[model samples]
Structures are given as structure tokens and as C-alpha cells.
Target: MNLFRLDASILPTTSTSAEIADTVEAEWAAAHPGATVTRRHLGTDPLPADAWALAATGGFAPEQDRTEAQREALGLATELAGELERADAVVLAVPLYNYGVSQHFKTWADLVIAAAGPTASLLKDTPTVLVTTLGGGYGPGTPREGWDHSTPYMERILRDAWQADLTVIKRELTLAGTNPAMAALRDLADEQHLRALTAARTAGRALAG
Candidate 1:
């Protein structure tokens, strides 16, 4: 089994999303024993700015004058596609920034989804897990619930474009002083996320077998 892990949390150390992803990866490795996992860290080295510009234009740049920037942009897209094609399962660890997925994560999604084939065909039927860490608490019934677009948008993109069966695990209220009673919520959330990843790994291994 091959697991593709994408980490898009900007924070280097105290990032809850990254910590959860680490736990998930560890759990996945433990469950699969011999399975291989490839990790892509988008926060450490962001995709070239030109990639964003080219994606916005929806056109490939001319080859004769193709600067390194242009090549890097295209390379990012190709690399992402290649990884997706080779993996049996995908895990995305992202932090909600202003009610949306981090820019790096969005860029990665755009590159993968831009392929010409049917969204589902290009992505195959890989199982996907989305883990998001938010600064404040907000759910389906909260007044500011509409601000929670990260999970919903991710679900729609993966399901519509890749026909992926996605499971979402959200960790909310990470801010300094949002809810006093929920002080230890982050650790609990991490435990739950680890379990989810373990399940995904088991399912992937069974399918491979």
C-alpha cells in the first residue's frame, strides 16, 4: 500500500494540523507495517508564485521564453499528478486560514484537478482523508457556521473531481482563549484523527491484498 501525505500547515512546530498529521502517519505505518508512505511538505517550500498566476490563466506558458519560474509552476502540477497516480490513498493535513484551506493546499488541488480527463478518471478511486485544524469553534448549527468552508469545499472537490470516498476529521477551537472548558480538546482531536488514519490504512491494505 502507498500513502500520499500532504502537509500544508504553515506553523513549523506548534501547528496542530502538523502534529495530527504526524500522529496519523505514525498510526498508518504501524497498521501497515511494510507499506510505503511518501510525504509532501508544502509549507516548507511553497509552489512558485508563477504557478498560481499560470493556474489563474488556465494556460501553459510559451516554451522559448520559459523562465525557471514557469518551469517550476508546471513542475509542481506534474509532480502532484504523478504522485496522485501512484498512490492508493491520500491524506491532507491542512489548517483553515480565514475560513478556507491554506493557499498551498488549494494550489495542489488546482494542479491535480486541471487534468483533461474526467475528474474521477484522473484521480482514480483513491481513498482520501482530510484533517483540518481551525482557530475557533464552529459547526453545522453555529451562527458563524457558514465560515466553515474548508471541509465542505474539500469534500466537494474530492468527491466531484476524483469520485473519492473521503472522511473528514476536524479539530476546532485552537485559539488562545476561545473556550476555557475545551482546553484539552486539541489532544482529544489528535487521538480521534489517529484512529481515522489507522482505519484508512487498514482498508487500503485490504483492498491491495
Candidate 2:
């Protein structure tokens, strides 16, 4: 079986999102020994910022008239879409950045749309695990309750758009352990961490099965 894992954390070494994803992956690997895992790290090797525009426009241009850049962009879009299309399962490790999606991750999503069409279900019926982290609490009643603009948007794309059998594992107050201002919430953060890890294992077992 082939599993696709995508990570979008600028800080890999200290990334809670990645840590949660690792738990999920470990469970899958244990269940299916020797299974192939394809990994793409958008934070370390981001797509070209302008590729989406070129690819989006390229789709309208006749193949013969497309410029070299547009041709390359379109190819890249197809490749990104194919990675998702071919995966038996998927794991995405993304974190809230500035209260929204990271630009690079956004670019990647745009490229997938450009290649697969806005409504294409590239992962139709496929199992997908989405692991997202937040530095602060944004649940209802929190000061930033409505400030999280990343999760809903992603769920729209992954669950609604792509039609994946989606499972989301989200954790908040991730900065409590590191940020002095959030010192009082460290216990809550640890609890969230454990919960996320447990969810990952459950999700991973589902993927393996």
C-alpha cells in the first residue's frame, strides 16, 4: 500500500503538528510492514509562488501557444494532483499560520485545484487524516474563537471538495509550553497533545485497515 504524507511546518524541529502526524504514521507503518510512504514537505521546499497563476491561465491557453513557464507550471499542477489521486491514504500536517493558511500551502492547494478542476474528487472515498495545530485556543468562548480561518477552509477542500473520508485531529494552545504568556495553560496544552496523539493512532489504524 502507498501512503502520502504532506507537511507544512516552517519549524520542523519544533513542530507539534509534525509530532502528531508522526504518531499516526508510526501506527500505519507498524500495521503494514514495508508499506511505501511518500512524503512532501511544503515548508522546506515550497512551490513557486507564481506557478498557480501560470497554471490557472495555462489551462485556458491552447497547448501549442503555451509559454515554457506555463507548460512547466501545468506539469507541476498535474503532478501535485496525481500524488493525491494515486495515494491509498493521506496524512496532512498543517498548522495555523497568522490565523490563516500558510501561503505556500495555499499555493499547493491552488495547484491541486488547477490540475484537478475546482470540483474534481481526487481522493474520492479515500481515507484522509488532517492534523492541524494552533498556538492558542480558538474554541468557542475563547477570545479568538472566530479567528481560526484555516480549519474550516481546509475541511471544505479535503472533505467537501475532494470527497475524502476525512478525519480531523486538531490541537490548540500549543504554545503554552514555550510562550511565557501562556504558562498557566501548559497543563491544558499537555492534555491536548496527548489527545491528539491518541487520535492519530486511531486514525492511523483506520488507514492501515
Candidate 3:
């Protein structure tokens, strides 16, 4: 079995999403001993800003007529799609940035779409776990309810577009103890954190199966 894991946290060591993903990956590794893992660290090595656009344009052009830039972009798309096509499972460690998806993650998604072409379903039926973290709470009944623009978009792209067997694990209130405004909710944050970690472990085991 092969696993494709993408990490989109800017802060490698200080990232909760990465930590949760680590647990999930560990479980997957345990379940499938000797399984190969393909890692892409998008946080530290972002995709080229124009890769998606170039790739999209190249798709409509003849192979011989494509520009060097377009060729490069298409090559990247091909590589990224190849990784997904080979993986039995996928893990995405994403942290909400500015209340929305991280730019790096979004760019990678664009490349996937371009690489897969219009009719090819490269990720169809693949099991995928999304480990998402939010510094602030956005659950229903919270003051910032409906403020999270990332999760829904992810659902649309990963589950709807890619047709993957998807499971989402969210860790919220990440800034409660550290942010002055959220100090009062520190206890609640800790509780939520523990729950999230437990869920991560559970999710990891699921991946292995």
C-alpha cells in the first residue's frame, strides 16, 4: 500500500494540524507495515504561482506547440497526479489561514485538477483523511459561526470533485490559551484539543484498515 501525505502548515514544529496528521500517518504505517509514504511539504516549498495557469493552457494546446513554461507546468501536474494515482490513501494536514484555505493547499488542488484532465477521475474511491486546524472556534452557536470558509471548500474539492472516501478531523480553539482575547476559554480549548487528538488517533487507525 502507498500513502500520499501533504503538509501545508507554515510552522512545521509548532503546527497542530501537522501533529494530528502525524498520528494518522503513524496509524496507517502501523496497519500496513512496510507501506511506502510519499511526502510533499507544500508549506516550505510552495508551487510556482503560474504553474496551474500554464498547465491549464497547455492542456488545450498541441504537445509540440506548448511553451517551455507550459511544458514545465504540465510536467508538474503530471507528477502530482501520478503520486495520487499510486496512493491507496491520502492525508492532508491543513491549517486555516485568514479564515480560508491555505494558499499552498489551494495551489496544489488547482494543479491536481489540471493534471487529472477534464474527464479523468484520478482520485476516485481513494480513502483520504483531512486534518484541519483552526486557531479560533467557528462551530455553530459560536459568535464566529459560518466564518470558516476552508472546510466547506475542501469538502467540495476533495469529496465532491475528486470523489474520494473522505473523513475530516477538525481541531479548533487552537489559540485559546495563547491569545489574550481567548484567555477565558483556555479550559474549553484544552478539552477540545484533547478530543481532537483522540480523534486523530482514531482516524489514523481507520486509515490503516
Best candidate (score: TM-score): 2
lDDT of 1 by residue, 21-97 (tens): 66656666776788988889888877665575664344354576667665666666767778878887777788899
TM-score pick, better of 1 and 3: 3
Clashing pairs for predicted structure model 2, backbone only: none
Q: List the residue pairs that clash in candidate 3.
A: none
Compose the digit string of candidate 2's lDDT tens values, residues 1-209. 89999999999999999999999999989988998899999999999999999999999999999999999999999999999988999999999999998787899999999999999999999999999999999999998999999999999999999999999999999999889999999998999989999999999999888
lDDT of 2 at 118: 99
Stretch of 10 with least lDDT, candidate 3: 115-124
TM-scores vs. true structure, each candidate: 0.76, 0.99, 0.96
Displacement of the residue 194 alpha carbon in candidate 3, Å: 1.1
TM match of model 1 to true structure? 0.76
Better of 1 and 3 by lDDT: 3
Off by over 4 Å in 1: 55-72, 115-120, 176-209
